[model samples]
Target: MTPLAISANGPRESYGDKLVLDGLGLEVAEGTVFALLGPNGAGKTTAVQILSTLIRADAGEMRVAGHDLAREPDSARHAIGVTGQFSAVDGLLSGRENLHLMADLRHLGRAEGRRRTTELLEQFDLADAAEKMASTCSGGMRRRLDLAMTLVGDPRVIFLDEPTTGLDPRSHRTMWEIIRRLVADHGVTIFLTTQYLEEADQLADRIAVLDHGRLVAEGTAEELKRLIPGGHVRLGFADADTFEVAVRALSRTLDDMPRDDDALTLQVPSDGRVRSLRALLDLLDAESIEAGEPSVLTPDLDNVFLALTGQPRTAVDPPADHPVDPLTEKAVAR
Candidate 1:
C-alpha cells in the first residue's frame, strides 16, 4: 500500500458569523490524485487553504508531505505547492521569465533554475511560448504555465483549486493529461478541488463530496455511484406479445416495473449485482418469459451528487461573478 502524503483530522474554520468548515477529516495516499468536490460555498476553498498552510484552521491536526502543518508550517510550505482558482502567472513577464522568477523565489540557484525551467517548459509543451508574454498566451497556455510555476520548487504535494474552470473541452482534456503525467511520471500527490464532475471522475483516484463544510460522502467514483439509488436492468423483447407477457409476469414479482410499449422493453429496478441478475433470470425462466436482451444501467456520479446533495448537478456552480476574497488569495500564495 502507498504511504499517505496527506493526513488531516477534525479541521474547523469560521469566517466571522459564517462557519466554513466543521471538523472535516481527510487522507490522501502518495502518488495519487485526491479530488475534493463541493457545491458553491461548501468550504472547498477553505479546506484547500488550510491544507496548503495558506490559512490557519481554527482547529485541526494536519500533516502534509510528512510535515506537521500547524507545528512546522515552514517545513510544510517547503513540501507543498499551491495553484488557486485564479492564474498566478505574471501577465507582464514572458513565460520563461515567470518561471525563472519562481525558481529564484525558491532559491534554486541560477544554474539549476535554468535547467529546471527548461525541463518544465518542454514537459508542459510551452517551448514555443517560452518567450511569449503571459498576457498574450491562450487560456490553456496560461494554465500550463501556472502549473509549471507551481512545480518550480519541486514540491512533493500540490493543491490545485478549480484548475480547469472555464476551459473548453479540448483545453480541459489537455490539463487532465498533464495532471495524470504529474502523478505517473513525477510521483506527485495532487489535491484537487473542482466543480466539474467529469474531471474528478477521470483524474481522481478517490473523491470526497463536501456539503455545508462537512464531508457528506467519500470513496472511489464507482463506490460513490453505488450509494445512489436508480440502478436498473433494461430487458428488451423480440415482439409486443413477448413484452406484454414478460411485463405481466414481472409485475407480480417486481414493484414499479416500468414498461415501454413502443420500444418493447421493461425497466426493472436492480442493484446490478450478479446474484440479483441470476435470480431475476431464474424467475423469468420459471415464468417461461423470454427477454431478447438485458442491459444494466448503473447510477453515475451525477446521480450520486444529486441524491446526496439534494440538488441537481447544475446547482453545484458557485454564484455568478463570485470573486475570491483577498485573504483567500493570500492564503493560496503561502
Candidate 2:
C-alpha cells in the first residue's frame, strides 16, 4: 500500500494567549491530493507551515513524508517541496535560469543540474519561453515556472498554498491539469490550501474545511456536499401533456414532488443514485410517460461551506482587513 506523505493530529499553535490552530488535524496519503479549505484566519497557513517544516507546532503529533516532524524536521524538509501563494521566481532571471538556480540549491552536479532544468522546463511547457525573463512571463507562466522549480528536488510530497489565486479561468484550469499530472505521473502527494471551493471540488481526493482555527468538516467532495440538503432530480418533458403524466407517475414513485408547468419540469427529492434513478425510469416506462431529459442536481461545496460555517462563504474574503491571529501570521510568514 502507498504510505502516508503527511499526517497530523490535534496540532495546536498560539501567540501568547491568542490561539491560532487549536487541535487541528490533517492527513495526506501518497499520490493523493488532500485539500485544506477555509476562510481567512482559519489557520490553514499555519497547518501548511507545520507540515512543511517551516515552523513548529506547539502541541500535536505530526509526520511528513514518514518523518516525525518534531524529531526530524530536516528529513521532512528533504521529502517535500513548497509553493507559497506568492511567486518565488525572481523577475530579473530568465525562466531557464530560475530553474537552474533551484537545481543548484538542491546540490545537483552541473551536468545533472542542466539536465534537470531542461526536463522541468519541458515538463511544465516552459521550453518555448525558457529564455524569457520572469518579469515578461504572464501570471500563468510564472506560476508554472514556480511549480517547476519546486520539483527540482524531486520531493515525494508538495505543499501548494493557493497555487491558482488571481489567475484567469483558463490559467486556473491549466494549473489544475498540472496538479493532476503531478500525482498521476510522479506519485507525489499534494497538500493544498485554498479559498477556492470549486478548485477543491475539482481536484482534491478529499477535503477538510477549517473554521476559527479548527476543522469543521472533512470528507470526499461528494460526501461533504451531501451533508447539505435540497438536492433533487429534474425531469423535463417536451410538453405539458407529458409533464402531467410524469407528475402522476412520479407522485406514485416518490413523495413531495414539485412540478412547474410553464417550464415543463418536475423536481423530485433524490440522492441522485443509480438505483433511485432506475426506479424512476421504471415508473415512467410503466406509465408510458416520457421525460424529454433527466438530470440530477446535487449540493455543491459552496452550499456545504455555508451550512457548516454558519456564515456565508462570501464573508471571508482573503483580502479583508480583519486581524489574523498573530501565531497564524507568524507561522505563514516563514
Candidate 3:
C-alpha cells in the first residue's frame, strides 16, 4: 500500500449545543490533491483546523506525515502548512519581508532564511515585486506571496481552506497551475476545501462532500456525477412520425423518458455506462428507427454537487469594494 500522507479515522467535534463534525474519516495519499466540499455552515473549516493542529478533535485518531496528531502534535505541525480562506500577508511588509518573517517563525537562521526567501521569491515569480509592499501587489501576486509564505517550513502536506476564494477566473486558473506543480514537481500533498466545484473537478484526485457535518459522498468527480440519474441520451429525429416511433420503440426498454414533440427529440435516461448506450443504439438498429444521432448529456459537477449536498454550487465573489480588472469582471459576469 502507498504510504498515506494524511488520515483521519472517525474524527468528531462538537460545540455545547451544535455538532460540527460527526465521525468524519479521510485518507489522502502522498502527492495527491484531496478536496472537501460543503455548504457555508458545514464543518469544512473545522476539519482543516483539527487536521493542522489548530484545534483538537473531540474524538478519534488523526495523522499527518506519519506523525500521530494526538501524541505528536508538534511533529505533525512541523510537517504541515496551512493557508486559510483569508490572506495572511501583512500589508505593511514587503513581499520579501513577509517570506523572511515566516522563515523566522519556523526558526530558520538569518542566512538560511534569506536564501529560502530569495529562492521562493523567484519560484513564485514574485522577484520583481519582492521589494514592494505586499498590499500593493495584484490579487494574483498577493496570493502567490501568501502561498510562498506557507512553504517556508518545507512542509510535506499543505491545508488550503478556500485558497482561491476571491481570485478572478484568470488568477483562479493560475492557482490551479501552481497546485499542480506542487504535486507533480515538489511531491507535496494538498488538502483543500473550496466553494468552486470546478476547482475540485480540475484539481482533486479525490473529492468528498460534507453535508451537515456528515460525509454524504466521496469519489472522483465523474464517480460522484455518475451517482446522479440526470444523464440522458437525446435521440433526434427528422420528423414527428419518426420521433413518435423512436419514443414508442424506446419506451419498451426504458422508463420515465422525456421527449420534445416540437424538436423531434426523445431523451432516454442513462447511467452513463457504455453498455446502456450501446444497448440503446442496438435497439434502434434492430427496429430500423433511423434516429439520426444521439446526443448524450451527462451530469456535470454542478448537478452532482446539488444532488449530494442539496444545494447548488455557488462562487464566492470578491468583496464589493475590491477592485477587479475589467476583463475579470466580465468573466465573473458570465
Most accurate candidate by TM-score: 1
lDDT of 2 by residue, 184-276 (tens): 998999999999999999999999999877899999998897787888989888988888877776777578888888999988887766887
Best by lDDT: 1
**Quality of model 3 by C-alpha lDDT:** 0.86
Q: Give the poorly placed runs of model 1, Cα more than 4 Å off.
A: 282-290, 311-334
Candidates sorted by lDDT, descending order? 1, 3, 2
Q: For candidate 2, what is the TM-score?
A: 0.88
lDDT of 1 by residue, 1-334 (tens): 8899999899888766567789999899999999998888788888888898877888889999898987898999999999889898999999999999999999999999999999999999998679989999999999999999999999999999999998889999999999999999999999999989989999999999998888999999988987878888999989888888888888887888888899988889988888888988998899898886689888988888777777523332233224445555322211
Clashes of 2: 0
Candidate that beats the other on lDDT, 2 or 3, i.e. the better one: 3
Each prediction's whole-model lDDT (CA): 0.87, 0.84, 0.86
lDDT tens digits, residue span 152-209, model 3: 9999999998999889999998899999999999999999999899999999999999
Q: Give the number of colliding residue pairs in candidate 1.
A: 0
Candidate 2 residues lying further than 4 Å off, grouped into runs, are 238-242, 252-255, 286-288, 312-334
How many collisions per candidate? 0, 0, 0
**Against the hidden reference, what TM-scores do the models get?**
0.89, 0.88, 0.87
